[model samples]
Structure formats: C-alpha cells, structure tokens
Target: MKKPKQKKTKEIRTSLLRRLAFLDRATLDIDARTVELAFSSEQPVSRWWGEEI
Candidate 1:
C-alpha cells in the first residue's frame, strides 16, 4: 500500500502571548491609538489577525 503524504501546517512563532482582549486601551491605561499600535506591531498575534498565521 502507498503511504499518504503529510499535509503542511502553518505554525506561529512568538516570544510572548499578547491577548487582544487584555490589550484594551482603557484597561492598559493607554489610548486607543497606542493600543492599536501595540496590537499592530506585535509579531505573532499580528500574523494571526492578518490571517497570515
């Protein structure tokens, strides 16, 4: 019998886990813009949000 080929799965790599819910501006004592910047620049989570993860 022939062996089945393995499927390729995308993996995310991050030094930290940044939860968006916890990144809220009001909770973090920062403005919305600052929170946005934090979320946007975050490496791993950014990819997941952008669907590139």
Candidate 2:
C-alpha cells in the first residue's frame, strides 16, 4: 500500500528587535510597568486618558 502526501503550510513569526529598531531608542525610556498600564488602561483608545493630555 502507498501513503498519501500531505501539504505543508507556511508559519508566520514576529521579531521584537526588528520592530524596535524602527523606533527611537529614547522612546524606550518608559518602564515595563508603565507600558503595561498604558496598554491595559484603554489609554490608547481614549485620547483624554493618555499622557498627551
């Protein structure tokens, strides 16, 4: 008996270093906690909630 061939799918992966390289090093001044809060606080969706205000 012969076995059937299976198709392979391409996998996608992300690299943080590659992405960070595009941004300024100075922008990394924010602490990990601050970034976590900023992202989880809905600040990104509400302009008034962000520090820009």
Candidate 3:
C-alpha cells in the first residue's frame, strides 16, 4: 500500500522562512498539545485552556 503524504516540519519551516523577509533560518518547530475545553462559572479555568477567556 502507498504511504500517506503528510506535510513535514522542514517543509513548513522552509515555507515560513521564505514568506517572512526577516526569518532566515529553518529552525522553527511545531508542538501539538491536547487542551481542555470545559468552562466553569464558579471556578477559573486553567491557563492552558484554549476555550477559556
């Protein structure tokens, strides 16, 4: 079976470097993290919560 083609980190970094005039090095990296989306009125949400205001 053929392997699925996914966007690589180098490709993304190179693309960003090319688009931004000031950005030259391809040292950019992406970090994916799971975030909590629950909201509470009585308690404050965590700092890492993406859905919290």
Top-TM-score candidate index:
1
List TM-scores for all candidates, in order: 0.21, 0.20, 0.16
Q: 1-53 in candidate 2: lDDT tens per residue?
A: 89889999999785664212244455564656332112223233435566642
Best lDDT among the predictions, by candidate number? 1
CA deviation > 4 Å runs, candidate 2: 1-3, 17-53
**1: Cα error in model 2, Å:** 5.6
Off by over 4 Å in 3: 1-4, 7-40, 49-53
**What are the per-residue Cα lDDT tens digits for candidate 3 across 1-53?**
99899976654333433222343234443354333343335544457555453
Give the per-residue Cα lDDT of candidate 2 at 27: 50
Query: Stretches of candidate 1 above 4 Å error?
Result: 1-3, 19-53
lDDT of 1 by residue, 1-53 (tens): 99999999999775975455444455443444344434443344345358442
The models' CA-based lDDT, in order, is: 0.52, 0.46, 0.44
Candidate achieving higher TM-score, 2 or 3 = 2
lDDT of 3: 0.44
- After superposition on all C-alphas, the RMSD of every candidate to the true structure, in Å, is 10.4, 11.8, 17.6
Better of 1 and 3 by lDDT: 1
Ranking by lDDT: 1, 2, 3
